[model samples]
Target chain A: MPYINIQITREGASREQKAQLIRGATDLVVQVLGKNPATTFVVIEEVDTDHWGIAGETVTVLRERARQGGAQ
Target chain B: MPYINIQITREGASREQKAQLIRGATDLVVQVLGKNPATTFVVIEEVDTDHWGIAGETVTVLRERARQGGAQ
Candidate 1:
């Protein structure tokens, strides 16, 4: 069984969107690796902005800075 | 930055348990790879038993069979 995990910023997706992601990811794995869809697992996690960081700044801070037109 | 995603069967852990897992995973990545904790991301996803399978059987089915003492 192949397990796929997807992470996105908090409140970034709707339930329907997440379902689509799970289905698409599973289909891709099955197409490429010949894995059984019934045996494949897909997990989607929504992370709080403060708990996710890039370039040493949390996503919360990055979004705030971007809103104010701050330099990247 | 190192990103870690942890998956577990749904309803199998508590909030505190997940926090511990996040901290431990982040610390291990930092210690082994010299990754910065500020930029490290950890996401934990709890998948429904129906969504997780092994050996062509869903975890829900497996648990049910085990409860009845059925052959694996």
Candidate 2:
């Protein structure tokens, strides 16, 4: 069984989107890795922007900076 | 760099417990895999019982059956 974990920032994605992601991930694993869809597991994790980090800065700060730069 | 994803049923885990899991996972990767803690990513996902499946049955149904068996 192959386990896939998809992490994304908690930006209010709908349940339908999550279901689509789960289906897409499982399909990819089955197609590329030749895994059985029945045994494959796909987990979707939504992390808060404040908790997800990039380059020693959190996504919250990074997004804010990007917004400011774009506005300037 | 190592990425660790821990999946568990949504059973009302506290923030401290999640933090402990993240720290413990990071430490394990550093010790066992000799991975850089800075580059290591640990994500904890709490899934609804209705979503997680085993033996073609969801955890919600499985737990209910177990509880019924225990009561009999």
Q: What tens digits encode model 1's per-residue C-alpha lDDT throughout B1-72?
A: 887767789856765566667778888888899988878877666789999999999999999988898776
Question: After TM-score superposition, what is the CA distance of residue A62 in candidate 1 from its true location, in Å?
Answer: 15
TM-score of each: 0.55, 0.55
Q: Candidate 1's C-alpha lDDT? A: 0.79
Instruction: Give the range of the ten consecutive residues with the poorest summed lDDT in model 1 chain A.
Output: A49-58
Q: How far in Å is the alpha carbon of A3 misplaced in model 2?
A: 0.4
- Identify the CAPRI category of the predicted complex in candidate 1: incorrect
After superposition, the stretches of candidate 1 with alpha carbons farther than 4 Å from their true spots are A1-6, A11-72, B70-72
**DockQ comparisons of all candidates to the true complex:** 0.13, 0.12
Give the distance in Å from residue A28's predicted Cα in candidate 1 to where it truly belongs.
Answer: 21
